[model samples]
Target: MITAPGGRTLDLANLRCVFTLQGWTTSQWGSAVFKIYNLSDDTANAIQAGEFSSIQLIAGYQNNSGILFDGKIRYSSRSLENKTDQVVTIQAVDSHDAKVYATINQTLGKGYDAARVDAALMQTFEPYGVTRGRTAKMPGTKYPRSKAMFGRSTVYQDLLAKQCRFLWQFINGQYVSIFEDASLDDVIVLNGRTGLLGVPTQTIGGGAVIRCLINPTIQWRSLVQVELQSATTGYFIVNSINCQGDTMGDDWYMDLNCTAHNNLVDKPHKDSSKN
Candidate 1:
């Protein structure tokens, strides 16, 4: 079961839910989508429409020892199957996106590396509870540049990370440390012990795709090792994730779509004049 955050203070016994989450590091992959389903409560009304709220979801499989997806809920929806069954659907951008947009105005000085730029962005985000590990490689000597803040933090962070060979995202409302390439090492070892659900199959992303039981331990950009005794046994970076489960019934799993360490997407080039 996954924990849902809201004003109502929900418990496992009182909720029913399912969700598919998509997270990304490259521009082509786009924003995170957390499509959530929930039964309408007789009293609480958790899925009301308004930009005044955010949700933190901690998802995992039946044992509750893993992290399927860890992030925020920024958008939502609802529908009816007759009057007795209702599913509240929610669409959320990654917390990193929300943080960048919510961060009103700030300016990074004329000279700073990508790592330093991330530090400045974190200043605006520290209060929101960020999650991340150590620095990956902040390669490229594009150490000094002039960037003035005209709008959202997303605009600025994207430009800086790309030029310096890095990318960032927010996990469960906190920032996961930016990395040049996250799949090079294995952070989570996946096999029969950790719910290895399939062998490598050809998927849309060109790299091999694997799905496993859901848990809250793995976050976007974290490394995972698939130790199956085949061509699939190797390290990979988490490209995307989908956390699906229902608390009202006995069904749940987390799907991880990853890119090999050597295949992480490149950040797009930004026109310096545009910034």
Candidate 2:
């Protein structure tokens, strides 16, 4: 069992981090080496699977004490010689050392909404058959990239557009604020939905708030002549919406059911807009 460190308020429940064999891939007698590096720091410490690693983060408070990691076996090959490493990482805490009380899980505050977002991302990308590759953009990059696309389907663009949409809906009412009439880049207040307005109250040059439609419930197929941002084109489904904004940064996150569409359709007038 992992223990919380001193001066820390939270700890990673190692037991809770369950792992499963996702799948197996064989590359016709090719070698594959995989490693996990800390994206939060400059040091590219390789972490071993099923162990803890230290990851210093910015923006949120973190424990100076080390961290824990749980990873799967990495497979590597160089033509018939295949090898796998036990998951590994830079040690953050000692099991026998004094437990520090630091906020170990930076995203714990995001709660279930964060989980929902992760699920959406995984569902969208995993099916595309993308694989991780060594980074030329930055030396010693550990994460995977889309090394190949079966049909050149532009999956990355679609994923980004969908993510932006999700962010837009999530920031509504929960992060409330109005943008200026002229400025394209203004920090708007985000308040999770309160059901007052189903759309963005502000926009530039009388255009569609494409980001505003990212919520799970906003049916994208119903739009008609609504000018959209270049990076966005899709539909959304609202599986469930929970609104409970009573405190600062407190949100009422909704469970969503989303879909994407490539064609325009006739816009149905709402009951309130009746003359």
User: Each model's C-alpha lDDT?
Assistant: 0.54, 0.22
Off by over 4 Å in 2: 1-151, 155-194, 197-199, 208-215, 222-249, 253-275
Off by over 4 Å in 1: 1-8, 12-14, 27-46, 49-52, 61-78, 96-116, 125-147, 183-186, 204-206, 229-232, 248-251, 261-275
lDDT of 1 by residue, 1-275 (tens): 22344444443344655555565545322233433344436422544535324444555545655433444555556677456666666555545445644463656566655556666765665555554434444543454666555566566667766776665555445444444553323367788777778675556756556677766677565567777765345666666666566655555655667766444224222212100
Kindly list the per-residue Cα lDDT of model 2 for residues 70-147, writing each as its tens digit.
121232111212253222222221111111111111121222342233333333323332222210111122223223
- Per-model clash counts, in order, read 14, 50
Error of 1 at 53 (Å): 2.3
Q: Tell me each candidate's TM-score.
A: 0.68, 0.18
* Deviation from truth (RMSD, Å), model 2: 21.8
Question: How many Å off is the CA of 74 in candidate 1?
Answer: 4.6
